[model samples]
Target: MKVTRYTKADAEQWDAFVRASKNGTFLLQRAYMDYHSDRFADHSLIFHDDKGHPVALLPANERDGVLQSHGGLTYGGIICDESMTTPRMLEVFDVLLEHLRTNGLNRLLYKTIPYIYHLNPAEEDRYALFRADARLYRRDVLSVICQDRRLPFQKRRARKVSQAQKLGLVIEASEDLEAFWAILEANLAAVHGVRPVHSVEEMRLLNSRFPDQIRLHVCKENGGIVAGVVVFNATRVAHVQYISSSERGREIGALDLLFATLIERDYADQAYFDFGISNEQEGKVMNVGLIEQKEGFGARAVTHDYYELSVV
Candidate 1:
């Protein structure tokens, strides 16, 4: 086995591997990872077997002697294909730890991809982590709706949808990101006291790069945008990356209407609908109201876990 540090020249190979990996997502693609290159000192790695065939890839960055699987991404770990077996993954971790130790890195922070993202049953990395004595550092709850076995919306949410329909709210694909960003900015500041992770320009750039994968859907009334959601479309899931509404939008239940259309019409065929995480303070805090809103839409829980490994 051999491990190689990633370089610009590896972009094409890396992207191809990610597309074929059972647990990989667009976030692992070089294009997406490189967007915030100026902020992180990338230390991504690619693994190869004795026959010189690539088997696994790790998207990571280093800071203060600690390596994070990927700080910019929501979740990232060793990306592998269906061919990766338990024993092979264990070997991969052995090599990974050795490489980290040799490189003067003392710790590793790994974020496991949620099971919903996998194209196949791929949890070999979890066993490998256990073998390496990695500790679970955090766990976040994501509310998701399984398409085939979806639960009916709660009474309050059902009423909201009816109210939105009576108000003549129209849910449709939208290209007006600037207008939505204003609402998102205000909503986050007023509610969470924080700003959107991506600036307007950054999101627009990403949208341009992955137009098909990233989309904006909005609810409008009288030709004016009132509520919107930025969805990141993966192969098996449609994830709500950002959701917000104007004051009038909330009164009329624009978000409820928008989500109903997304889950029941636009992406009805998708396997899962991810409402993203509602946890704060590194998973130690749960925002009850925020999670309740998602649960009311018939979504259930999925946990996203983080692990810490000492490279001594």
Candidate 2:
């Protein structure tokens, strides 16, 4: 395979290839990746087969001589199609490392696309990572619900949902960013002491670009937003990208009601529903209370891993 450095001229082909990739999500698309291009030194690459047909794409960025695939996204690696066999993956890695070394990059940080996101069996990169002697640096666990064979929601969560229902909250899909972001920002500041990854303007722009893929669902009380979640919809998974609740919302279990509506009514048809990550500090610590709340909704664990590879 011939490895080619990505260029703006390659955007069309790059996006087409990602659409056809086994594990590709809209997050891997140029439309999504380029939204914050100004913040990252993009070092993405495209691989062409012997006949000059594209085989894979690496969505990556370079920082301080280390290449992350990619620092901007939650998870990314070699985005390949069904043609990616184990031996072929090894060849790709060999070429990838050589390309990195030749380009003066000494280390590569690879973030894996979790299995639940795969359109087909796509674990060849894992086997190849073992061959390359990559080190596991981080592992974040996401709470996921398998739709068809879902486990029953814990009684505790059920009770909360019931309580929330008694409050007469309205749950609906919305385009209201101001109300939701206000609640989200305040909640994050008070509880986590951090801010949302995307600014209100940035999120609005993204929503406009991919309205169907990115959605906002709000739980409101008397036309005022109390709790909300931003869900990123993919072929097999509907991932909760952001979630927050106001003090009033929490007291009445507003989030529980919102999630119950999503899991049972809104996204019941999806194969998996991902409740983002619970681990912090580069996966060293688990937030027990947060994860237990997700588990109460019958969501189980799915790990997203990061590997460090020596390219020198």
Candidate 3:
């Protein structure tokens, strides 16, 4: 087997591998990667057999001596073909690590996907063999609303949705993202204790690159902004990319109302509603409960594979 850097010609194969793999994430999509490639200081690598058919893929972002498996990618690591035998996976990993070390990388972080929502068993086992020490991170709880709509509710979520509607909440989809970004950034710092993932330029670029895929859903009340959500309809799944609101939003159930409206309109036809992940490291308890709130709406939790590798 041989390992090499990815090229423009490999786009179709790369995406095909992702679509076929059980552990694939939206981040591995060609369009998503290309949309944010300019922000990262690295590239992607693929492993192939003598037949030259692609078998495994690793998209990493490198900076200085620290090498990460696609930093820009929410989930990263060696996503391999499920049919690959353990021996083949080990061999592929060996070559991949050797390449990284020889290239002056001090450490290799797999950023092992913690959720296996759809990973093939063989690919998951490959990750198991290489992981050294595992660090438990925040969980990205998912809900299959369409599959089991009668989920147990801890609070009156559905009723709240109705109340939000009664409270004169208006949901609008528009291209005016600058207003949303301002609210998002401020909310991120205040609530999550972090910065927004995308800059103004990056968001604009992505918005232009994926117009149909990206959408800004805002919930207004009393003729002003109360809450807003950035929803991405990448495939069959409708993911809540980002959500934010002001002080008044909490009082009037603006957020709950906004999400309810967005889900009804944007994700109404889809089967899955990805509420995004909660960062436990950031002391985000309210958000953690919010994930559970989604579960109340008949959402299920999906876990991914998280792996770590040491030089052998």
Candidate 4:
């Protein structure tokens, strides 16, 4: 086996491999990862077999002598295709550790992709991590609804949706990012006292690049946007990347209406509806109110774990 650093010249090859990888997402693609290239020192890796055929890839970055699978993405680790086996992954990690140590990196942080995102059964990396004596550093709870056997929404949530319907709120696809950004900015600031991770311009650029994968859905009242969500469609999973509501929207339960329509109509065919994470402070703190709201919609927990491995 052999390992090599990723380069601009390998962009096409990298994207092709990601598309075929069992647990890979579009987020790992070069176009997406490089959106904020000025921010991180990328040190992604590509692994190949003795015959020189590409076998696996790692979307990662290096900072202060520590290599992170990818600090910018929701999850990142070894991405491989169906051909990858437990032994092969172990070998890959062995070579990967050697490469990192040779480059003077003393530690590595790995984020495991949640199972809901997998196109096939691909958990060999977890076993490999255990074999490598990696420590569990963090574990976040993701609220998700299994579309095939979805649970009924709680009575209060159902009532809210009914009330929203009675108010004649319109749920539809939207192109008004500026308007939604205004609502998102205000909502995040008022609730968390922080701004959005992505600015309007950056989101617009990403949406334009991934037209089909990225979408905006809004609940409107009297021709004005009241609430909205940015869904990142990743094959089987419809992930809510951003969700927010205006004051009036909340009063009238616009979010309940929007989510009901999205889950039942827009993305009903998808396998799962992921509401992202509800943990804070590296999973030590649980936001009960935030998670309860998601749970009201019949969502349950799926964990996203982070692991640390010593390179020395």
What are the TM-scores, per candidate, against the unseen true structure? 0.99, 0.98, 0.79, 0.99
Cα lDDT of model 2 by residue, 119-196, tens digit: 999989999999999999999999999999899989999998998899889999999998899998988898879999
Return the clash pairs for model 1, or none: none
Q: Which ten residues in a row have the lowest lDDT in candidate 3?
A: 132-141
Error of 3 at 10 (Å): 4.6
lDDT of residue 239 for candidate 3? 74
**Model 3 Cα lDDT, one tens digit per residue, 187-269:** 88987699888876787887787788788888887777778887776445667778888888777778777766656665777
Off by over 4 Å in 4: none
Quote the positional error of residue 218 for candidate 3 in Å. Answer: 1.8
Per-residue error for 223 in candidate 2, Å, reads 1.1
lDDT digits (tens) for residues 46-72 of candidate 1: 999999889999999999999999999
Of the two candidates 3 and 4, the one with more favorable lDDT, higher being better, is 4
Residue 202 in model 1: shift from native, Å?
Answer: 0.7
